[model samples]
Target chain A: MAEHAPSAKRIQSETDALIAPGHTLASITEKIASLALKRRTPLGWFVGFGISFLLLQALLYTLAVLLFKGVGVWGINVPVGWGFDIINLVWWIGIGHAGTLISAILLLLRQDWRTSINRFAEAMTLFAVACAVIFPVFHTGRPWLAAYWLFPYPNTMGLWPNFRSPLIWDVFAISTYGTVSALFWYVGLIPDMATLRDRAKSKAWKIVYGMAAMGWRGSARHWHNYESAYLLLAGLATPLVISVHTVVSLDFAAGVIPGWHATIFPPYFVAGAIYAGFAMVLTLSIPLRKAYGLEDFITMKHLENMAKVMLATGLIVAYGYTMEAFMAWYSGNPYEKFMMANRMGGPYAVFYWLLILCNVLAPNLLWIKNLRTNTTFLFLISLVVGVGMWLERFVIIPVSLHRDFLPSSWGSYAGTRYDWSAFLGTIGLFLTLFFLFIRFMPVISIFEMRTILPEGEGGEPKS
Target chain B: MRRRGTGTPDIHGVMAEFNTPHDVVEAAHRVHAQGYRKVDAYSPYPIEELSHALGFHHSPLPLLVLLGGIFGLVAVYGLQYWSAVIEYPMNIGGRPLHSWPAFVVPTFDGTILFASLTAVLGVLALNGLPEPYHPVFNVPTFALASRDKFFLCIEARDPKFDRDKTRDLLRALPGVVDVVEVEH
Candidate 1:
């Protein structure tokens, strides 16, 4: 059977090709497994885990104190009822948007490069949404009965959650963002789970993977259904991601507070999401590429492409800043002009400057290819951008609302220890989740990788 | 012209393997014309034309999920309205009854939650999940399914299944093998 012999030989060659040279899946699996197992130890993951645990503990203590002591434990006063809590809520919600932008929007665009980062990004979206939902739901004076917001009673107590309230809008935006993101992430994981299922050496691993794969047989019929479902989900998620961020902006836009009532908020917020998202991607990807040695998969080309997007969005955000300034002056609204003037020339001007430095100035370094390719430089810049974006949200929310329509109601705002610690706690939670995700999955879609084979069939660019 | 390997009298069906999905669909048409009504084909990738040859019907999953999501939205909105404005109207900012804009966020979230839940649940229920074990695992080389191997099972569960006739029919085709019954 010459035919049989050649086919047999071909099969062997194919197997060899898959696991050969620097591309051995076994070696990759071993490296990841070793990292994961080590990371489980108190010593290995101590820095991340301990930090997260401590932050969470501090947050719990602070929240308990706040709940027990009432909302007065913080600096929020008459006019600025929505202070650091809402600021942090919007900030976290904004952070959550980036993940879906990478996972859903990039997937729809057919950008294969998104595979390396989408899983972690999607997870980030979920965690960020978790962090977001916390502030709004619990920041209320009576978190114990936050359920009262949802009930439609006919009583004369007059305690109905204002349907016109942007706070109500946020509840919808953040929750929908979280739910849809979770679905998209899980569906994306199924094929990968099947891969793990087929490759596992241990019986326990096999069973775990098998259950997660949901009996994926790699049937043609199943693939058809899977692809269709994915396309449909992508269609839903892309617009949903955009809508979520736009609605988050509306929280400020809907208000009559001088700096908050801007018509340019929707686009501005979206641009900021992409900017912050790309910044975070750079932050994570730089470290990840070096640690996991994924230079080939998450190449400089991908980084550069993302950097260009960052530069564009950064400029747009700068424009939005300029527009807000111009609109204040042009509209001839005395209060609006005074609010914009105060933001630039008043007590919290340091935050405004930091936002400018981090968001506008930091990303300008991307123009230099040497800086873009230098992982260390990219990491530093990313950290700056990330910090800047958070500050941007802080300045937008607290400063704007701290003194709104009437200077009579104006008050100098300051975040308490609880505010600072809760924010730090969220950072810990985000890092812990990110680290765990990188350890388990390939961090890159293995199937999607195959499609990118430079010399393989169907390798040509799609028209 | 039946084979005796399966040790059964009535079983007969042809099996064939093709390198590309295009070849597989072309072969399916030929097999169907040769009166092999019981024949089936499989490939590593989906071949659209083959579905037509196999006469597959429409799936109701999308419609089911959409309807489930709509029901969830109605239920969530109705309950929220009942509780906030109807049962306990605690006025804070002097907002009126039937405050629909404020209801928009929770209603939207509930609708999405319902839709997503339905999609996930529908997929799992339709697929009959928690399938910890399967006979395919017993076929030592079946792991190749994840890679390049293509396979089809004309199960004994099928009405036309016959061991001998299936083997004879399979022999007439190229690269066919075993013709074994998939015992559950």
Candidate 2:
């Protein structure tokens, strides 16, 4: 609340509003819910959605080709046996971390600014996780069996998944992460769903939202239970956000490769995940808050806080890179030294420098408070960070794998046409899902917004 | 919970609207003090301390999750041991069959999985949710409970069931907008 504290007379004079000026709780529901119910589709939404849909179709096409031609359609042959598929899997999974950080971690830390963005961010987490799992399953070449084989169910074949393998651990980590994130997201949506149910204009939408709300009556008893459950979920989810990416990094580090075998990976991966995740959040929120005219809810204060997080996490990621280089030299091992030298000056040198530029240099702009507060600058910088994070994965995976212990075994690799399609297509799929989410659900948690209003104003912002 | 008879106009309670969450908390305290046992307060968001004032002071969620997490830790760790060590074993790098060190990651994951699921199910079951309908929704303006308003519903089943006295009690509260009959 931005309200000036009252004197003994208790005049209810307003200070600056936290949400858009003059929008009461009633109008908040009307404004957000109407976008769905009224179905006044914006041209920008169509243009964005159309492109994403096309990319999604392209992804599907590539999948069909992959299924038909087998893993041969990709560039992972012999030495470079983990190409764009693994890169994408790591990328999407890393992207999912930001949502959990916002919704669960920030909630535990009592950061209320997250209320404006947490709902959609959790939705982003779910979608990104959804995009992520597609790669590993399809990469297995037989997804149907890989799906069941990945789990440890008793079978007539008399086999179980290798529990020692990080790949198997990844199956557990990602699936559990997905389940918890989904439940957390849905639990938070209940009261707001009830709000939508009540405010719905049409009978169909009312019933749809009614079922989604699960008869939430806003009772003190219900909120008490709901709040407790939410807090518990947050506590439970906090560890998963760190653990999922740590386990992902283990997939690389557990291997015998010199560059991959490092003690710094777990925390390093976690830091990089947060760095990329915050960047993506900024990328989505800057445009979203502006277009929806939710400038007050997703205030400049909120934007600046996110930039600060990105800066801090980005620096940690940069430190991880430095340590990785230092450790390679400090070890005094030829293979390790070669791996470090290769990363710096090998054929992938262009990508390595680009990664530095995007991940390290671009986020440096946020050090100046003005650049971070500038929406266009933040958007572009965030995009650079997103690309930088991708390149970081590329350098870690394909570049490292392209040449290994034996000179005879060394072979350079490039992603085929199908590989690019799969990667880009998932991006499209992510955006498409995001568009539907923004159009249908309350992107900002409506009920939570009420709590932020100043006292005695009756949930109404003054004009 | 105790539905008095059937059909519409079957009076559930006298529902009153409060201007802000604070006023609702104050009215709830006053009503609870007035020996109204079958009272419930509704707000657009959780009002801190309001639940305790309205006599919903305890929740079993944390305990349920704790127990669930312990059970999950043991169950998942044991399952991995049995699968890798006892049921079928392979000599990959000639490591130990139990591989208890390798079990930690999945065990941590399983604990989270079970704990979170328990929280969701426990909440739903305790709240008696997936309830397609509620009597509160029958109160037409009760929709405002999800928006700007806070409501205090005094069920007719309470011993002090004088409709006029209850209405007067609510109307006397500061910042109360209206008191209306809520029927199922």
In order, the candidates keep a fraction of the true contacts of 0.37, 0.85
Per-residue CA lDDT of model 2 for B1-184, tens digit only, reads 5544222234778889877777888898899999888899998888766887888767988999999999899999989999888888888889998888899999999999999999999999889999986677777788888877889998877877567788899889988998988776
* Deviating ranges (above 4 Å) for candidate 1: A1-47, A150-161, A451-463, B1-59, B65-111, B164-181
DockQ of each: 0.33, 0.64
Clashes per candidate, residues 3 or more apart or on different chains: 40, 0
Candidate 1 lDDT (Cα, 0 to 1): 0.67
Best by lDDT: 2
Q: For model 1 chain A, where is the 10-residue window of minimal lDDT? A: A454-463
lDDT of each: 0.67, 0.87
Candidate 2: residue A251 Cα off by (Å):
0.6
Worst 10 residues of 1 chain B by lDDT: B10-19
